[model samples]
Target: MEKGLLYPVTNAYREDQKLDGLWDFKFDPASEGEQNGWAKGLADPIEMPVPASFNDFFTDKDAREYTGDFWYLKKVFIPQHFAGKKVELRFGAATHRAVVYVNGQKIRSHEGGFLPFTADVTAAVNLGEENIIAVKINNELHRDALPAGDTVTLKNGKRMVKPFFDFYNYSGLNRSVHLLAIPQGNIYDYSTSYEVSDDQATVHYQVAADSDADIKVSLADEDGVVVAAATGQKGELVVKNPTLWQVRDAYLYTIRIQLVKNDKVLDEYADKIGLRTIEIKGHQILVNHKPIYLKGFGRHEDSIYAGRAFDLNVERRDVNLLKWIGANSFRSSHYPYDEQVYKLADREGILITDEVPAVGFKMAAASFLGGLDQSFFDGDWIDELYKKHIDQVKDMIKRDKNHPSVLAWSLCNEPDTSTESAVPYFTKLFNDSADLDPQKRPRTFTLNEDDTFETSKCLKFPDFYLLNRYPGWYHKWGYEISDGEAGLRAELDEWQNSDIDKPIVFSEYGADTEPGLHKLPSIMWSEEYQIELLEMFNRVFDDYDFIRGEQPWNLADFQTVEGNMRVNGNKKGIFTRDRQPKAAAFYLRKRWNSLPLDY
Candidate 1:
């Protein structure tokens, strides 16, 4: 079975409940919840909003940064009429680890912090009766965990969430929770990949069912006209003179899969699918066989109080901002975003570089602090991390494979690829992902400035290249303006000479600038300096044919761990945390609007 089988039914033709809004919440700091039987019911639980982070609610900073077990309890009343149907409790996402219990009985558990998980509550649920849906959530990090970190106790005897990467570890229910009363044996999974040639489309599709049932699949255009229809478990449907999905010119067709028997529609499932193709050819990325340029930012599914939760109000604003800035593509950065983000991208013709939450990944935490050695090789730890890392890759690929917006799959972000021992890990991961994806999207990983093609043997694994370099910010900070440009140019020239025929995108590149800070001479933390650095980088980007895309470090300022270098968070965003555009946004808007989307 595919890893996506773990995901909820996307195209359920039956009735379901959206378990949004407020729920009874509590923090189990002492870890005595099981002994106290908190799962049964909390004695004095405070009301907290669902689909948002619990960190931002408290007045104390310590409460906001708590990393241990927290509970979200809700009482749901299932309708008596839906008793015969199979009901499920689906969570959009829970932080690092989650345990679900229904009516005091443990139902299921999931480990991923950003992926959806479901539990069957048909037997546990009391129809027409109020039932307790209790969830015990934890965000403590282990070395073996994906995006590994550690829980450290300080000299004062206080534990802290010490992350290996940047960004605040906001924990809670970050996405929607659903109560799906779907049919017992309905269409669970289906996907479509297409071959489009301007005027024609040949769509290959597959459907998975719980049991044997006659299936009728149809392709409907925007006009609600069925272009092609078929009957089978898997087959091809052809449409003459079909419209192709394009960046900023997206077109889509509805795929309706119906379960039929004896002239009766047993159950039907439907979703909008875009007909597009992606390919790679000699240092260029092709969309629908046409070489295209990617113009966008590396955005996170993050915000003020919601943290990583999915909010349509914020989502719509973000989409409008991207469109207003003349951007046609974006990377999910270190993690996969909510499913609705992809849906919006598909409709607006926005391209995507779907990524996994494999950030903070390294050989081991001890290796970095012990001797600061770059070449520490451990057989046992490598195997353990690889096992955990590859599982996330499969889950990410399977859940996001069908989206037209996703142009490629990013295995990780800025991992320790400079080490020689890391070569086998990347190679193995890339190979494992190839087998899981049906779309066969080009796979790549983001490389930091330290990971050079010459030094890192792991560089050979990816289909393309993505480097995160901070020229003016990190390498040539003290150099004069002209000298810094030359320094950046030198690095690019060396990369151009490397002779690797693959598309290279600067997945991250920017200097942290305080929003209103400005100086005539241009200095660090100054707005002028930020604009100047970006303009210089853009010039260098234009000069290289192999550099197909340039996504600045972030779309907006986001919360991160408290440190001297960080003013609340990473200020590398073109916009502030509230989505207000800074000097960089305007600069990119003008440049992106003027550039040709195709090479």
Candidate 2:
């Protein structure tokens, strides 16, 4: 495959096209012999693509849900012209744990299911000939794994432990696989720090890699002219007075770092780093010393087709929609999103709040009423959970930290009924945030409509206090036509007078209604009601100086198999599952863009 092409893995039997079918297969149980023995058998194995699950390929329905050890193999012949070149095997993403083997040699092993991993296998392959590559995937359910435990319960009362979230978890090599050719000791990772002041700008650059490599680093202007260059220890380099990147004026500059060894250029990588300062003072988020109100929505990485597979076209479509509606920011809600989304946001000049997928609690009706057990939050398992959570967060930051669009790193979303213990969690997260990027913005969490809860009130002095209030959607009297506006107004007034004196954000506030399912003029789920509710909130938001932003309940409708009244899961999205816009979308677009009155 080419360097940057995106391929998706899907169920081979389904109508959805899949690329995983082209792979070879095997099954290696924990009781099996050494991993090397399996690696040796890769030359002649059952051929299948990485896009399929064992259940998808087998006739037995019972095996469809089986989670255990499985081996996948594929063979590719290297071109003679690419001989002696540094070849890296890159897996866009995999689930749980994966170990890669090349021609009977274990090359690399990676943990964490969401982030990308690569292994340099140039020495293990024979150029100009067929090479056998095998990958071992272990999908066993472990309580220590992130998003652990059974999320969905079956009608037969059988509970299955899976990576449960609001959307479907389509496991396997669900992303892309590629073989990239580069020189040795190339750019492994790079960090860019911009110090912008009134008169001048300075940029600190750090690059990491293998020993004593001659690295050439330079910053280029918008017109592609070199502005600065420096050579330093190991692979570190710095460039000062680089052109600063700002919002609105958004002056962007590219830093090109080339790795050379023995007078031959090995690898070259370029990054677009933005130089600007962000500060929050007196309920205002200032970028480059100017107050900017954020109008945005929370988004989940789910498509009608591909499940969690990353699609560049789909990401671009979502960003275009946000831009069309005059949105300047996005919240990667519930979990961390694909790196491509963050890159697009930086290029398009949108503010972002990247979140870690620490969304706890069982969402069943019985579980909701009974509430999450406090014991679940306490134990030795809690430490492992926090470690896994922090690992995921660090991986996300490492991959997307250079992008200026990211404004804050949200620790977690509505961590189950916040208690005094929650304070320590946030405190630890705050310390971690400082360790990762001290110059970046602070971290925060959201407090939904449970003000009476001590945990909610105690989180007042946090970096930012976000409220997810949907007065007309969840209140007892919300269904009544006469009480809708009055109830919302009263709630807003009460919240404004609360003891918390920090930057406020309406993190979530939208009603779920099936698209094209129009109701009479008086119903809460009606098209008229959705638009009216948003307008009422917008008016109230305009009057409040403390509320710095408002992200509607969701950007698009996502999957929830647990059937609800309106539709499957929450239907409260401006767009449908297939990404069709609702009638209320136009009103929001007009209001956000400050377009002429046309309602």
Candidate 3:
């Protein structure tokens, strides 16, 4: 069954009770939670809030950098009215891995940290009585996992995570949890695809539910008027004078679906959709048949207190900042973000390039460590990682396929595409995703520095190319700025002359700048240097017509693994961690606000 992890909404047919706020928490360093019966209750546990990371809550080093099993226990009452309904516990996300338990009985387990999962507790919960919900979560990173990393055992026998990527390892529930009371045989999943004509649009929809009932679908305008209606499990709704969803100017239509038996409603679900089409024509990206130039930043969910946690207040602030800076789109870099981010983007008319957590692949991580003697695809680990990678891609698409703001699917970021082995691997991913998504949006992956136009073998799989180039910052530093510009131009000339006919997007390019650091002539790590670097990149970008989008490295400074290369964290953001503007922020704001949407 193609059941989607739909956002639990409280409506006439459903009840959603929040299981957020404080929960009893404790660390199980020895992994003895199951043996010692900690699932029944956590002994001497401390209060930890749901939807927040536990890393920065304490001042001690061990607590902040812990790597082991941690448990959270919450007691909730199951109302007697829900006795005949299907009771389930839905988690927005659990970092890395999680296993849920109800009344000391294991319910369900899930891997991959960025997507939602559920546990059917209808048979386990005591009706009209208090029930214990225990969740055991682990935050270990290994080469076989997504966002690959290694665990180092210190001499003291404690474990520490040595991540292949640059980001810090922050773990927790990270998002809200809820207790849902739904009808026993309800709408499990639904999908919508659009076909726009000159004046009319046809929306094709498919629904999966209990086979005993009949399905009815309707399309409505914002004014509470039904535009089209159909009766069946699968059908099409035709509407006249459709308003297509646009970048920064959105118009959404509501799709209400009902499951009926004998002319009476058994269950119903309502969701908003924007009727838009995204495609690539020649060297341009088109949304609703018009070309668009994407202007935004690659942002992280990290914040002052909420390290990678899903906070609506923080999300709203980030969106408002994007509007102020005249950005119409952003990429959820490295991994998928909370579902609320996509819903907000849909309402605000902001575009998104959704990505899975298939980062830090074999070749890139090996290069980062030192050098690899063999091909990246020659290991047993690669086979396991590939299986895990495909699962994440499937789950990510299933959850995010319906969103109009998601214009593309980024399969993986910076894999080892230089080798011939990567061709078949990425080919399978691109081909499979084409069948999985109903919208059939453009698919691509971000390219690293080593995957040059001449060396990359998997470039043909994607509809467009996304490059992460750091010319002045990582290549030519300090006084050698002119050389960096010359090198960048040389590479651009190669791409322009290459046989590839796809559009190019500068997915990442930025310099790390201290907030108040300044130099007269613009040295590295200074605010002036960042502005100079951006200007140089923009000049190079304008020289080529195939260059369609420019999204800088980050929107705000974020936490990273401790090293001499990072100053407390990565300082490549145009704003501080608290979302305060840097000198580069104003520079980009002026540039982006003046540029046309189709530029």
Candidate 4:
């Protein structure tokens, strides 16, 4: 099996087609699809949208939360012109796990679902003839899977996926699908980064190919003039007066790579790169040798009907909201988002802390570290889960390493890093992640609040600190607002006196506020209480210079597992589910807008 490309380039520069719209779907509850030969295609199937989750479309609650196998069928005719070229079927993403078959012939089986995967179906399908494409996707989160969980069948025959994380398990073909053609022995993979000195920028690049071929690399300025060119498998190109990619002032250069043999161009690829460098220096995060503060939110890939599917309209609106709130950065909380978001971030100069979807290590939903019994390190499936965790991190870095907006890489979210057993697992995971990326970007994890700064076995591995704290909401109860503020200040003071020299980011802060709820004196779950909590936290940020960044718990309300503490889903967003602003949103906008661009 061939390895998938690091950055999946489309034939959009050439010949490609979007395999989106509607397709036939069926649920294989008995897991008898293979024995019954459903690969040839289901005889009669229900109509399902190509890229959307099948949960909300169904009326039966049992079907909405079904934990078994579901099949999707689509038919296509490969044009005769694609006969000589290498034809491939690419799925943007299929939840948890998937198997693809073309014309009743098995093509590929992929483990992780959040990243794109492709199968070289050049020999599996006949050109100029209609071919049946069938995919069986499963969202069952056993211990060996990336997002680990288990399901239980009730007496009513309803399958319920237990909550290990704080997000909904909306599953299906949750991203786009495409069919593209590329020349054989083309530019298989490449990586590029820049180093700025004085007024000049040097681009160091490497290209990998199937066979020995002449590699041509060019850097075109924003004005469409080729500034520099190189010929080799790996080399450097220097450009003068490079326009550095800055916050809210994005400037990019186009890179054109070509494969040439005997002066004949066999294949070509084009991408954009930002000429800038980022590093962490002395409790300060610097970009292009200047310190810049991070103000954003921990965001999720969620929508009303699409679930985790990528929607361009939603993407535009979300970015607009971020701009309105004066935010320039966000952590890809819990998981890496769709690739389109990364592209938009690059274009808009939005900084990102890219994260992998290894989210369920805590096993406890509400209280932090309450599920030591369900901790990832002590599980019987530790070896298998650790391997899967490593692969997920590698896949995330390889796919997202080229993007300029990605400032850091998060290994996991809210995991128990406080145990002795977690030491070797986290140390090896962070080391392997660094080995995978050529640039070796900053690495960190979302430190659970239960883990103290001094005792956390893995905190020393992160380049900086990303903490999830809820002072006013969670702890120091049975007290007035002043007491809550005092408790929070004491905690910060302890962290400051601990003499840890790393820059810290308050990754998760803010209270759950229903859109219209209000209280005169301020109370939990009300708009006034949410604002009060944030204002109190804001005071601490002003006091501590090491607090380099602040990203609230969430940007908008999103769906999660059903529970009594949650109303429909988590309501901790400054904006409502439909994109309306809450009272806290107004206060947050005012505060963020006051910060200077360089802050």
Candidate 5:
């Protein structure tokens, strides 16, 4: 049975919780178990925390990097009072691939690092006794893993690699781990689809369950007023809207589903669904029949304290800063984010573009193509990588499709260099998404620039065209005369005049700046430089009509190997790394909200 309730896992670094402790670890070079016979036999034991990487157990020299199979073991006990309860083992995240074992019995295995997966361990756990949990993880860097290509050193002594992107890849249980107790028959998965007409609105509720139980479903407004209710033998219900939800109106309704067995409410789940219509026509993005511009930024799911580990306070801080800056949207850059982000976006009225982690080039492909070198495409790994990426996309859409804030399903980020190979993969993903839910259309891949041959080639595959243009930041235009405003206008005009005939989104555009660092106007990552750049872009935005939206390079200062030594990434956030607001914060908020800034 699929366990559907979302539960919080312990943050990976709680010293007092005993969830972050040392564990017995061994690496296996062969496909078969040979290192310590741990995978086959479970006599010798070591201890590890629920939310830790194998590197935690290794010494300095041995832990620097990991690139093979590593096994982890830990003994946990379920209290006698907790016995006879339905217990499930949930993993917040694990890198590459992982197989889980409980008491030496294989329970489940999963692939991917940014999403959550679970296994029902009630049957495998010995009731009221100590149970051993083992996890085997495999990490292999391959090309065709997404963005294809290699490494380079810019003139400023800054380095750029094929992960051609930013952010460190911290392998292991980087998210969270939790043990949940629930009733025997419970709600598995719940999703809602909304449709609106002139008079009445219809919402379809689909639910999955573990047993044939009676389910009660209800729809209520912002206030606790029920507008609809129904009981079903199977897990399906329908509701008619009393008041629909829209961005301008920002009205949301809650759909609550409760499982009833033997005259008792066993488990309950509720989804916050908004009623709205989104359409793309010409070069405008319309929500509920009104044109709206997406003044936003691209985001990475990394924190200074937790890295990629789950931290609710950090997530709240990120969303709060976005609202404070007057930005209305964000792109989950390069990868899908925690599910909670989507819910917050819905509640806060922020538009979002959810993306998958189909990034980087493999080593072999980089050598063969002489382009950017990324590990995602190495060694004839296209089919496997594509399948894995597709699975991640499916999981993302299925889990978060009902969110009103999700504007589009971004297939990939700046996968320009490998257009030919990436197009088919994106097409399949788009088609599959359409089949699953017809409410949202698949937005094809995004390109870094408009003139690249790859961009023109892949234009036909997507429903809309999104270009990531940073002319003032990257082009060879003279620094003496800033092209910040002119560059944006020129790129928008070029795309508007192009024969692609698809709506254009300024997918990425922004400059980086240290929050309080003052420097010369020409230098990047300084408050002065970032403000100048943003002001120019904001002016162009005021005059342009062809562009539908603009999502700046980033929302907050994120950690990047290249960013550390040389501010290589556009540190162009309205807030600092610790979420302190910068001077540009007020400027962006004013522009996005159509308010005039005195500065």
Candidate 6:
């Protein structure tokens, strides 16, 4: 089995069958699955969907709040088409972590669940007959994991999750699962880089294969006309007067690659690519050497019923809503979203800062101020956490390096950087991640409220600054509007004088508002207050020329861990959870529509 992440595609040499449907599931609150031989089959299993979170589908609170080992079993059949072919089970994602067992034998174990993984189950399956596949999933968060959190045990001997992050801990098979069949000596992986001249663009490509063979590549435009062709594992293809992939106006080219020997094609792979360039020149983020002012929201892969599952319908609706609001870009806040989401972004011409799942290293959840503990960096678990973090980073870059819509790599979101240890930690990480991508896109990490201009030790690490501030909402709530504005100005003044010339993007800033709740004199949790707070932030943003972008805290309301701070879920979304417009939606639409793409 080749150990590379190549997106599964259907062609003459490959076929993908989605293994998404109802499956036998059982919750292991006592963690007795392995000991009881449950990996072979769950004795008394309940029916659940494969590509969905089991939390919201259940009626009881225990099932919805489950925080331990769970098992899913599904029966699959391998088609009889002779022999000597490669077959694998590819999971788009399994929440937190998962271990696979086929026909009562352990196949593979994967960690860090937001990315894709494949297990070569060719030998374990019975060709032309039914085979059993069992997966054991664990959702207990540890300090040594990405998006760090703790697993607490109660006096009743039940386990629960206390995530350092604010969002709900939705777990299970949250993305599509597919059974893939491919020929031997298939194309394993590929990457592309670009160089633009006055009227031409040259694309540099490198392909990896399981066996050494003659590599042939061709680039085709929208009209199905081949613009460029090359023969080699690594070569360049030049197109005259190339149509650049612009923000909100995307143009894509199809790249087809093949492995050939003695005039016979052994394997073929095709993917869509957009040629563009992104860089930070002084205080502006330039796309194709032109400035871009991002007007969007920090989005989550969340919705009702599906939870975090990759729902194409919801994804389409969200992108349409963003376009309706005149948004040009968005950050995949906190974690890497579904791969299909990025593909949609490429087609729709939406810019994205593709982030990894490295969120919430803070010591607390409710307030960033109270998280003063440096044990997250100083503890013995730091190395393990960093290793897992770098592993996820490598996976993220490998999976998404070629997408033109991805403008930058957001390394972390709101990580604790108050201590001196953050200096070396982030320095090494930033350098390592920069080397992984062929384009060498700009790298950034969102700064929390605690990591101010003077307090942040890793301020100089990123190519640009992505700050998540809640001046009016978190710092100065209620009638202290003037004080919040003054505090915001004070912070901006300090940043301006700090000699940091990097472009600044307000990655997250918003207030939670109840739908239809209003008051004559605006108060917290009221729709009027949410609008008032955002307008205040916009005024301050316009005063500073260094501010390059504004993506409010959220695109829509989403579920969060149950607490007194949250009612049902986080209500900070400009749109309601069901994709209906809130008052803030219209306000943002008016403001964003007036701002040009280059503003």
Error of 5 at 388 (Å): 1.2
Could you estimate the TM-score for every candidate?
0.96, 0.81, 0.98, 0.96, 0.82, 0.98
Which digits, one per residue and each the tens of the lDDT, describe model 5 over residues 421-488?
A: 55565566666666654476446667755335333445666676667776666563326325655655
Runs off by more than 4 Å, candidate 1: 1-13, 363-380, 478-484
- Compose the digit string of candidate 3's lDDT tens values, residues 391-478: 8888888889888889898988888888888887887777667887888888899998878887788878889988988888878877
Candidate 4 per-residue C-alpha lDDT over 505-595 given as tens digits, one digit per residue, 9 for 90 to 100 = 9999778788788778877888988888888889889999888999998999998887766788888888887777888878988989998
Pull out the clashing pairs in model 3: none
Error of 6 at 430 (Å): 1.6
Cα error, candidate 3, residue 10 (Å): 0.9
* Tens-place lDDT digits, model 6, residues 5-25: 888888888988999999899
After superposing candidate 4 on the true structure, give the runs of residues whose Cα lies further than 4 Å from its correct spot: 6-14, 366-374, 477-481
Better of 2 and 5 by lDDT: 2
**At residue 271, what lDDT does model 6 achieve?**
93
lDDT for model 6 comes to 0.89
What is the TM-score (0 to 1) of candidate 5?
0.82
lDDT of residue 297 for candidate 5: 85
Global Cα lDDT for candidate 1? 0.82
Which order, best to worst by lDDT? 6, 3, 4, 1, 2, 5
lDDT-wise, the better of 5 and 6 is 6
Give the RMSD in angstroms, all C-alphas superposed, for model 2.
6.5
Please write out the lDDT profile of model 1 over residues 495-574, one tens digit for every residue: 78877789888888888889999788888888888888888888888898998988898889888878766898889989
Lowest lDDT sum, 10 consecutive residues, model 3, at 363-372
Error of 4 at 476 (Å): 3.4
| Candidates' C-alpha lDDT | 0.82, 0.65, 0.88, 0.82, 0.64, 0.89
